[model samples]
Target: MDDKDLELLRILEENSRLSAQEIGSMTNLIPAEVEARIHALEESRIIRKYTTVINWEKAGNGEVSAIIELKVSPERDFGYDRIAERLSRFRQVRTLRLITGTYDLQLMVSGKNVQEVSRFVSEHVAPMDRIRETATHIVMKSYKENGNTLFEQQEAERLPYSF
Candidate 1:
């Protein structure tokens, strides 16, 4: 990707709602050109889904969040992919990662309460054929969850000090 594409991505990452004209203004490109480049980016799957970052606490839905580490039976006889696919379908699962170390998979889960989360792990996750053991850590509060892309745009748009 060229510098223009990188700039476009930066803008879109901050706010996907920005119009092609608005993006064009920021990048000094014509609206049509901006539109075409955006189209190309989308078609190439470079720009995936546009999403909103909601503060669950402010929304009054924040109850609890947990990180679960799962140790699964080795995939020599059984396939881990199938298990991962099934785990991914759960509503409470925010993110799942297959990683190295003592654990095979790491899962980020959010629920209304501890009971709800425990039920999900015991009933849904534990019952799986390949799962050997699981460890869970409840999050009290997040110091930093995900970094804000908008901050970069704000910095870029900041005016220089006038002497």
Candidate 2:
């Protein structure tokens, strides 16, 4: 991708609602060129699905979230790939990563409540053959996620001078 393509991607990442004409104005490309380039990017899978970041807590649909660290014994031939693939398929699993740390695999999972999440871990995750140990840390509150601050900083009110 060229510099113009990269610029388009950056603009889209910030706000995917921009029209081709609007993006063209920003990137100095004509609307038709902008549309063609965007199509190419989508076809090549460089531009994946556009997303909206929402604060679920404020929406009143808040769910319990947790980060679970797994100590896993890698499969003989496939290594961590097989286990990672399996974990990714679970509906509750939000994000999964292979990190350089004490844990072999780490996953972010969510559910309606603490009991539901705990039950999922005990019944499904911990009992898996390759999973040797697991550690779950529940997320109590989120100040920022995906680069968006959950709370806005309001200007403090001042009283009239008395002294």
Candidate 3:
């Protein structure tokens, strides 16, 4: 809402683990003020849940992720809101967006394996009445996610040259 609040949000967005005292130091506010502002932000729903991004490959989770594009016929009055709300209830859906593109909606979904994801698409998503078409793309690897790089880049080692 104010400049100090915006500054606090920026700092928290980068690292949510910082203490109110630490945030206060950066924002030039007292710890109590920092805490109160952050609480207000959370109550207003401007600051969503804090999350940690994990490199699941190294964790050995073997999670299968897919990006699904849906072409749909918008309902009369409600437009995409009705369908979007219904789709949001599905546990597999991680992210959903309505964008200016060929498809009306896009969804990010994940499951333990490809079969599970495929079954979700076929049984739950594709059969929906308003959904005209669906395209599912499986993710093979992730180099970066949520502003963090998943892999570390190393300098190439060169062979010794003869005189």
Candidate 4:
């Protein structure tokens, strides 16, 4: 991608709600140009989906988040993709990643309460045929829970010969 595309991505990453005109102003491009660039970015899959970053705690939803490590049986025929697909369908699952370590998969989940999360694990996740064992760590407090970042370009300035 060109410099213009990088700038557009930075702006969109900070706030997807920004209008094409607003983005154009920041990047010194025409509104139509900005629109077309954004469209191209989306088509190329560089810009995925525009989504909201909610403040869960402030929303008065006393929910708890957890990271569940799963140890799965090695695939004999089909593959791990099938098991990953099935687990991904769960509404409580925020993010799932296949990792290289003792565990096969890492899952980020959230629920209304501890009991609700426990129920999800005991009733749903554990019973899955491919799963061997599961370990969970509840999120007590978030120092940074995504979307809390400064997008100012100047903030990333590095002095010459600093390194």
Output the number of the lDDT-best candidate: 3
Which digits, one per residue and each the tens of the lDDT, describe model 3 over residues 1-163? Answer: 9999899888988899999999888988999999999999999999989999999998998999999999999999999999999999999999999977899999999999999999999999999989999999999999999888899888899989998
lDDT of each residue in 1-163, candidate 2, tens digit only: 9999999999998889999999999999999999999999999999978888888888888699999999999999899999999999999999999987899999999999999999999999999889999999999988898777898878998978986
Pairs clashing within candidate 2: none
- TM-score of each model, paired residue for residue: 0.79, 0.89, 0.92, 0.81
lDDT of 4: 0.89
Candidate 4 segments whose C-alpha is farther than 4 A from its true place:
76-78, 147-163
Model 1 C-alpha lDDT per residue in residues 39-71, reported as the tens digit of each score: 999999999888887666656785789999999
lDDT for each of the candidates?
A: 0.87, 0.93, 0.95, 0.89
RMSD (Å) of each candidate, 1 decimal: 5.9, 2.3, 2.4, 6.5
* Maximum-TM-score candidate: 3
Comparing 2 and 4 by TM-score, which wins? 2
> Clashing pairs in model 1?
none
Candidate 2 residue 102 Cα shift, in angstroms, is 1.3
Q: Please state the error at residue 97 of candidate 1 in Å.
A: 1.5
In angstroms, how far off is 20's CA in candidate 1?
1.6
